[model samples]
Target: MLLNMNFIVKALLGLCLVNSAFSARILFVMIAPSLSHHIFFRHLIKELSFRGHDVVSISPDPMNDPKLTNITEIDIHTETYDAFDARKWLETVQYNKPSSEISLMRSFLPLFYTQADNVLSAPKVQELIQNKNEHFDLVIVEMLMFNAHLFALRERFNCPAIGLASLDTSLNAMDAIGNPTDPNYYGSFFTEFSGGNLSFWERLQLLWHHIDFRLYYYLEYLPISDAMIAKHFNITDKTAWDLEKSVDLILTNTNPIFHIPRPKVPNYIDIGGMHMRERKPLPKDLKQFLDDSKQGVIYFSLGSNVKSTNLPAEKRAAILNVFRQLPYNILWKWENDTLPDKPANVLIKSWLPQQDVLDHPNLKAFITQGGIQSMEEAIRSNVPLICMPFGGDQKFNARRIADLGIGRRLPFDDITADTFLDAITDVASNPKYKKSITKLASVLWDQPTKPLDRAVWWVEYVIRHGGAKHLRSPAADFPWYKYLMLDIIGFILAVVIIALIVIIKVIKLLFRIIPLKKIKLKEQ
Candidate 1:
């Protein structure tokens, strides 16, 4: 018996050692100022730390949870918020403005550049970067806006890096991972055009935008970012492009149910809705309000970044006018102490537990700005949407909701009491929108692996393999001409031109000989 016990103890000790070896030390950087964006990264960060990884997180929003002992949070919220006032930017957005992706990016680049500089200069970030004694097995970075932090992949820590995006893959992210930017079918977040059935003008506009955006990015944005990287980190050996291509994998927040299906490389993984968790109980007042609403409730919120309080007085009145006439109760996320001229049936709250509220059975329709995360929550709860997008990807997501037959999209600038009432009534009274979204939600939940688990698995896979270099697409190495097969097309055109010339010359010579022979015969 003693001999058997000794053998079992040794085996158990070996397993513990193996488990310890697998736990990685990760440097997770999520410095974006938006809270909605951070929520997604926060879930992943907590999951990794809970799974025994020593996660060092650098973010503008820190969870500061004392129970999460495995994570070391480096806060840069103050500096980042100061650099870019999200609220001011949101307030200034023209809801009626058309999409001009290149122009929009051009205006935002300087702001992002300044924000990146501030993030790097923050005391905690500086200390973390300069600490040569600290090492990590992996580094994860949010690949939106500014990617100056990518310099850490090589210059600061010689380890593999994983790029994370809070929204569907962007043109720059696709370019970095060597994935095809199928602009014809997959119009970017800023553009309303998506899918293959495009008009002649739409096709023309898309192609022009693709070329124009690429020129601006490569010529202007890239050089500025490269200079910033060099100045901040003393990284003279690699440009921003070089660092972008060094990414081992890209995890995008996209799903086939929500985003158009497109070709993607192996390393470009979709872990959309990874932040989704089981619905919790709602607060008593909200719960009672929903329970008492016999006609059902319509939920309204513009999401975290865009505040409803900032809506123009006319627009706010229009929304309120519609709410007053509706038999159904309204729950609005107002983001203010009180709403002026509020309806008796409508309840306004400064903040809401959005997911829990959506999960309530009495909730019928969602009036939203069509943010991706909000759409995911609504889809899961089988709530149809009435999207009035303001800016950014919201336009694309709103258009998609209409295209998918999951709901309706209203133009914010075009909205009035009648239009608002029509949209809400159509979406809430009609059964088709709810049914379509329900079917989509089923598809979303039918995946073999849960999104969070899949994300965690990929993170660990990178650690286990030391890098996902083998999975990197070969197209990443191809230049523009080669990738487009322009060389082959040029060669084929040359051969055809030469053959055509030879045939014409031979025909001319034959005609001349025949005319001379006829003249000679006549003279004889």
Candidate 2:
């Protein structure tokens, strides 16, 4: 009896130890206050918490609702930018050309540097790091904008970190891990599609743009980042600043069907449709609106950054006039209550449940500014789109969707009631658009598991496997010259030059010897 009790106690202790070892605490950092980014991170946090992981999020504000109980919120106020005023910057960009934009970005680098500095220098960030009593097993960081925060956390925690790219994980993070972005892939930020096929001068401009990016990141961004990390962690021997070195895994919120094939590192996981999970319930009014709309519904949203209310009066009037004439009920995600005129068929609200509205069976078409999250939701729900891309990556995303035959792009400046009506009419009346969307939806869903599930499972898998060291890409350690294949090409060119030189010398020597021998024979 005594022996059995002792054995049971020992077994219980071992089990407890095992359980403790397997448990993980993950910290998520997000900088953007945009709704799309927030929603993506919110779903990920919820999924992680559901899997019994301790998840903490650091962002400008706690965007997640109160329902997400398990996730702790750390509020860090980074520099705020008016997304509306960006239109002025963009107008300047267009007028001055790409080189001017590069120069503008170079000028703007100091602002981002200052923002990163402030966030890192905050008392809360410092307190979090110094509080040795608090412990974390892993760090998940949103890899948009500045990477300074990520580096700071990695150096401070010295734990395995993962990157969560809210947009398609093609260029920025994937490039860091040796995955070359395919120029043919239209949606990739690095592709010719991003800047359009350029002439020699334009190409030079693009090159300058890239160089500008590198310079800004290395000179302004990296030093501030490294300084923060060193100050907090007390590490003096910092060498290179490779973001891939700081992260153990990268989970992209992009679907494979939408992206071109590229070599994926072991640690890189594509979890594109992670935001398509079903919510518990729709608001009663929204539900009734969907049910009441016998003629089907058209959803119009400019995403988080570009507000419809903020549009110039002419543009706003054009859209309003178009919406009034449309036969279908319009659910406009308007940020303001007062508009010039409200049509009987139009429902204007400060905000709407975007995913929920998209999921409604009556939702026939989406008129959008071509945000990736909105596009993903429309694709997932088999709804066609009329893309009016304003700026930034929206143009690329709009073009890709249009190329897929599931959508059409209309420039915001060129928008008129007739054009808007015609575009919306075509998307609604045409069976081809619905067919294409449905086909893509089938492809998106054909996977063994849902995207959100895969994301959740993999995040937990990282935790269970003791920080997923196997997923770290070896290319992260390679020198830039080697990673870019410049060194290999240089070596090959050098060898060819040396061989040509040797051959030329040998030929000259033979010619000289033969002439001398001929002379000697003639003399004899």
Candidate 3:
């Protein structure tokens, strides 16, 4: 019996060894120049490297982790800042809005394509690709914007590819993996409607959103991205369209806690809150500030992309006036070195440990820019929010917070003392906001395992199973008409038409042969 037990143990140990032997070499071509995007991809690489996978990460920001042994950080220089200016973006998006739908679509394409062009044009990226001996098992591309350009990397390596989206689940991204975009219920990227029955107008807006986005992609976005990738890579065998279509799996930064109800296939994984980490002790001054506050502390941040310092002087004064009047001590993330008038209650820091601040015991409410990452941290900390969104999916995210009954949206244009006071007071003082936020926090936290663990497991699963092709739906391969069953509908309609035509011909022939006069006499 002892010998039998030993045998079993030995067999299990050997099996473990066999599984551990399959250490993969992964290439993370993360060229997103945003800090939030960089942080998420950096977390992923760290997790993968911790599990003994050799990782080559091409990113603007590098985590020079002495602890992580299996990772190579290739520092990349992208002209994202040179190409796109956030302060300018804020000015245009807020003050001078696009005139038409075409103008809106045209306005946004450059922000993404500029990053694409710059990343591909980077010296290190070109070097990494041109190297003949450097091989990888899989390539993970940060695909928030243009996916087709990065798909060229997969073509070069002849390996499986996976996409990572920094934003919420995108319909175009889902389309790449063959998931259905049921626009009937699925909110548009900016509408940010939570799960509820939509009004007729809302449904029409969704339908129009679907139509407009698809039209924009095909007519304006697709051609530009395709030409860029082809010209840069000298792509010969397949079109840029095929390159994007060949992607195996896409990981979205959306959880059921935050996202509306949408059907996703196996290939589409939700690894939301992967960037979340254990909170560290706050700085001494910050801790003291929070602890000493008679009321609670309000944490305000505009996230990484948009700097709070860029706010016009008048706007700053308006917000400051409100903060001065409030009982709460406000920790504002100000980007500049110095300011003229200092409010006594407001502490202006060029940078902040945002999650730690939100986790404080004296936290009454969060005043935020409605970035998804900040919203996730607030939820995790069970802090209610007063959102002021700028652009992109921030509008949707803010609306979602309001829809969940956990927060209120205050427009930047209307940031007067009274409006700010009302919004902040409502979110902070209300029991319902706390209750709703806490409930969702509990739900979001109650996972089978850590989100990071799930993400790593799926990443390994893809590598182990050779690209998750079985998980890929046939809908991905289908043309638009076939996927929507328009062809099938057309065929059915054609058969019905043919049947009607034959029946009409038979009636006419009978009327010609059989005398109508005799039929009339018989009736008489």
For all candidates in order, the CA lDDT equals 0.85, 0.71, 0.81
Candidate 3 lands at a TM-score of: 0.92
Candidate 1, after superposition: displacement of residue 101 in Å?
3.0
Report the error of model 2 at residue 468, Å: 2.9
Predicted model with the maximum lDDT: 1
1-524 per-residue lDDT for model 1 (tens digits): 99999999999999889878888999988877888988989889999988889999988889999999999999989878887865545444565342575776677778877887888888888887788797899999898645744545555788889999888856777887799986577667767768868887887777777787788778878887787778777887788888878889989899877888888899999898998998898899989999999899999999888889888899989899999999999999989888889999999998999999999999889999888999999999999999998776888898889998999999888899999999999999999999999999999888999889999999999999999999988888888898899999999999999999999999999999999999999999
Residue-level lDDT of model 2, residues 1-524, one tens digit each, is 99999999999999888766666788887765455677777888877776667788877757557877778887764443332134444444433444443366565666655656566566776688788777787778877535644655665666767788877653446556655543332334432243344366655545554555566656665676566556656655762265435666788876667654456777788887787766557899989998999999998888776777777777778788887788899998888876668888888888887888888999989999887788888887899999987655676677778778998888766788788889999999899999999998888778888778887777777766657767666777677688778999999999999999999999999999999999999999
Candidate 2, residue 510: Cα displacement in angstroms equals: 2.4
lDDT of 3 by residue, 1-524 (tens): 99999999999999778757988999998765567778777778888987778999887778887877788887764455565544455457666765533456578687767766877787877888788887889999876545567888888898999998777755567778888777777854555463568787878878877787778766778776787777777886677678887888888778877888677888888888888998899999888988998788888888887788778788888888888888888888888876668788888899889889889889999988887888889999999999998876787888889888889988788888788889988888989999999999998889997878888988898899778888989999999999989999999999999999999999998987689778888999
Indicate the residue-level lDDT of 271 in model 1: 93
Model 3 scores worst on lDDT over the 10 consecutive residues at: 187-196
Instruction: For each of the candidates, give the backbone clash count.
Output: 0, 1, 0
